[model samples]
Target: MRPGIIDRYILRYFLGTYFLVLILILLIAIVFDISEKIEDFITRGATPREIIFDYYLNFIVYYGNMFTSMIVFISTIFFTSMLTNRTEIVAILTGGMSFRRLMVPYFIGTATIALLSMALAHYIIPISNVRRLHFENLYINQNTGERYSDIHRQIKPGHLIYLENYNPDRKSGYRFTYEVFDGQKLLSKLSSDFIRYDTLTGTWRLDNYTIRVIGTDGDKLVIGRQKDTLLEFKPDELSPSLYSVTMMNTPRLLEFIRAERIRGSEKVNMYLIELHQRTAWPFATVILVLIAVSISSQKRRGGMGFNIALGLALCVTYIFFQRVSVVFSTNGNLSPLAALWLPNLLFAIIGAFLYRIAPK
Candidate 1:
C-alpha cells in the first residue's frame, strides 16, 4: 500500500516544526549565555571575533548535542499531540491504516536523529571540545592554578609507573616510580624523588634515584644518585585533565580501559563509564521518542499543555534515573553497561506498556 501525499506532508510538517522550535530555543539560550560571559571575555583580552565565532558557536553545538535526547522527546510530543488534537491521527487510524503502519515514518525520522547524535558525540563534537576547552583555559582562565594530581599506574607490559606530584602548568611530575615484574617475581624497580623534564633535552631527568634488581635467591638493591630514563610517556599524558578524558576517541578509551585493568587501577571506572555511556546514550533518544509518541498520540481535555507537562515529568524522571545509575556504576555497585543502560531499559519498558494501551 502506498502512503498518500498527505502522509508525506504531515511528516515534513512534524519534522520541520521540531527542528525550528529546537533551533529557536537554543538561540535564545546562546544569547543569554553570551551576554553573561561577554564581560569575562573582554576582561581576559579576548577579541570580538574570537568571542563570537570561536567560543559561542562551538558552545551551542556542544550543548545541542548534549541535550539531543530531550529535543527528540519534546519534538515527538509536540508534533504527535498536534496531530491528535487536529484529529488527523484519528482519521488516519480509522481509514484502514493500522497504528503500527502510521508510526513507520516517525520511527524512521527518530532513528536518523539517533544515528547522527551517536556519530557526533563519539567522533565529531569531541574534536570541537578540544578547542572549546582551550578557549576556556586561555581566555576564561578557569583552570589556571588547578593542576592535576599525579597518577601512579602501570603503563607498559610488566612495568609499573608512578608519579608523586604533577602540575599541568609545568607539564611535569615529581617523584616517579617505574618497576618491572617477571613471572610472579620482582625484576627491576626504578625510584626517583624528583622527576623533572629538561626542555632543552626533551627528556625527563631523575635526581637522587635508585635501581633495585631482584635476584634468584637474594635481591640486590642498587642505589644511584642521578640518572635519566628513556621511558616513552610524558608527565602531561599521565596527569588528569578535563579535556584529556574527553579528547580520547573510542579506540583510545578502550586502550586506556585495557591498560588500567591490567594495572588494577581503581580510578578507571569513570573512563569505562564514559566509553559505554556514549553508545548507550544514543539508544535512549529512540526510547524516549517512543514513549513521547505513545503518550501524546491521544487527545486529552487539557490538550498540548497537558502533553507538555507529562513529557517534562517523564524526561526529568529519565534524567534522574540516568544520573543515579551512573553513580551506582561509579561506586562499583553496578556493572558499567548495566548502570548506563538501566534508564533506557526501564523507560523502554514503560514505552511498550503505554503503546499497548494507547488509543487506536
Candidate 2:
C-alpha cells in the first residue's frame, strides 16, 4: 500500500532523526574511546591510518549495532515529542485517524532498522569483530593464551581424551590419556607422560607411553619410550578463550555449540547465550520504538523535556534488565532463550500497557 502524506512525513522525520542521533552518538563514543586508548595506541606505534581504517571503521559498526535500540528510542522520543509539542499529532488524530493508524510509519521505519540490526548481529558484526579483536589483542590489550589443566573431552563417539595440563603456545601437553569404550566397557587405553605435535608429520608424538588392552581373560599392557599416533583432537580445540565464541558467525557458532555439547563442556552456556542474544537483540528496536512512541506522543506541560527524561529512564531500565538477564544466563541456571528474551517480553508488556493508556 502507498503511504499518505502524513505517513511519508513521519517516516522522513524518523529516518532523518535516527541517522542524526546514530552519527552524533557514534562520534562521541569514538572520541571518548580514542581518548581512553590513545596512550596504548601511541606506545604501540599504531599509525593514524591504521587506527582509522583498521580499528575505528569496525568500531563504529560494532558499537552502532550495539546501541541501535537506544538510538531508536532516543530518536523516536525526540521527533515524536516535537510533533506533539507542535500539536501535529493532535491535528492528525482530530482528523479521524486513530493512534494505531499513526503508528504505521513508525513501524515501517523501525522494522527496517530491526532487520538491519539482525543481519549485522548474525553475520556482519562477527566478521568485523575478528579484525577488531585482533587489533585490540595486538595493540590495546593482550589476551593471554588460553590454557587448560585437568581437561577432558569426548574426542568422538566412545573415545575419550584427558590432559593433565595443556599449553597452547607450546602446542604440547603433559600426562595425556586416551581411552576407548564399548557400551560402558573399557576396550583399550593409551597413557603418555608427555605429548607434542610433530610439525613435520602432522601427528602427535607421545613420550614414555603405555598401552593397555582389555581382554576377556585379563589386561594386556605394553610400555614404550616414545610413540606417534593419530588423533582427532587438536591443540586449538583444547584452548579457547571465552571471547572466541563471539567471533564465530552463525553457522560456525552452531557447529561449535553442537560439538561442545557432545563434549559436555560447561562453558557452552556462554556460547548458547550469545547465539540467542544475536536474534533477541535486534527485536528490541521494535519494542523500544513502541515504548518511545507511546510515552512521547502525548504533549504535556513539561513538554519535550518531560518526555525525553521519561524515555531515558525507560531506556536505561531496559539496558539494565538486559544485562541482568545475561548475567543470570551466564552465571546461574536460567536457560539462554528465556534469559535473553525476558527483557523483550517484559518491555513488550509494558509497551502494550502504555499504548492502551496513551493519548489517542
Candidate 3:
C-alpha cells in the first residue's frame, strides 16, 4: 500500500528524531569519554588528528551502532509521547486510523534503522574496529599480553595436537604432542620438546621429536633431532584474541567458526553467540518499536519522562537478558541461537499482550 499523508508525516518525525537523538547522545558520550581518556591520549603521544579522525570517528560509528536498538526504542517512545501529549494520537484514532494502521510508519522507520544497523554491525563496523582497536591497544592498553597456554586442536579427523605455553609473537610452543587415532584404537603418537614455525619453508619444525607407532604385536619408536612438517594451523588461530572475534566481518567470522570447530576449540560457543547476535539483535528492533508504541501511546499525567524512563528500563532489561544469556552460552548448557534470541522472543510476547490492551 502507498503511504498517505499521515504515514509520511510520522515517517519524517520518527526518522528525524532518531538521528537527532543519536547525535545528542553521541555528543555527550564523546565528551565524557575524552574527559576520561585524555591523559592516556596525551601521555601516549596520540596526535589530535589521530584522536579525532582515527579513534573517535570510528568510536562513534562502532558504539552508536552497538546501542541502535536502544536508540530506536528511545526515538519511538519520545516521538509517540509528544504525539500523546499533543493529543495527536487521540485525534488520529478518532479520525479513523486504527492502532495497527498507525504503526505502519513506525515499523517502516524501524526497518530502515534495523537494516542500516545490521549492515554496519556485520560488515562496516568490523573493518573500522581494526583501526579503532589498534589505537586503543597502543595508547590505552599497552601492557596487556596475548599469550595463550595449554592449547589443543584437532588437525583433522581422528588427529589431535597439544601444546603447552604457546606464544604468538614467537610463533612457537613447548611440550608439543601429536596423536593419531583410528576409532578408539591408538595409531601413532609424536612428542616434541619444542615446536616452532619455519617461516622460510612454511612448515612447523619440531626439536628433539620422538614418534611412537602402535603395531599388532608391540610398538615401534623413531627419534629425530630437528624435523619440519605441516601442522595445519597457525599459532594465532590457537590464541585468537577476544577482540579478534568482534573485529571479524560476517564471512570471515563464519569461516573462523568452522575452522575453530574443526580445531575443537572450547570457545566455539562464544564465536557462535557473536555471529547469531549480529542477526538477532537488529531484527529485535521491530519488536522493541511495537512495545514502545504500545506503552507510550497513552496520555499520562507524569508526561514524557515517565515513558522514556520506562522504555529505558525495558531496554536495560533487554541488555541484561542478552548478557546473562551470553554467560549461559559460554559457560553453561545454553545454545547460541537460543542465547541470542530468547529475549526477543520473550519481549515479543509482552508486546503482543500490551498491544491487545493498548488504548484503541
Best-fitting candidate, scored by lDDT: 3
Off by over 4 Å in 1: 147-150, 216-225
Of the two candidates 1 and 3, the one with more favorable lDDT, higher being better, is 3
lDDT of 3: 0.91
Candidate 3 residues 97-122, lDDT tens each? 89899999999999989999999989
Cα lDDT for residue 179, candidate 1: 85
Ten-residue region with minimum lDDT total, candidate 3: 141-150
**Tens-digit lDDT track for model 2 on 1-360?**
223988999999999999999999999999999899999999999888878888999999999998898999999999999999899889999888889999999999999999999999999989989888878888998657656799888878898989999988788999999999998999999999999997788899999999999999999999999988888887767766556887899999999989987776777888888899888988989999999999999988899999999999999899899899889988999999999899999999999999999998
Q: Superposing every Cα of model 2 onto the true structure, what RMSD results?
A: 2.2
Query: Per-candidate TM vs. native?
Result: 0.91, 0.93, 0.92
Clashing pairs in 2: none
Ranking, TM-score, top scorer first: 2, 3, 1
Each prediction's Cα lDDT score? 0.79, 0.90, 0.91
In candidate 3, position 357 carries an lDDT of 93
- For model 2, the stretches where C-alpha displacement exceeds 4 angstroms are 1-3, 143-146, 198-201
Models ranked on lDDT: 3, 2, 1
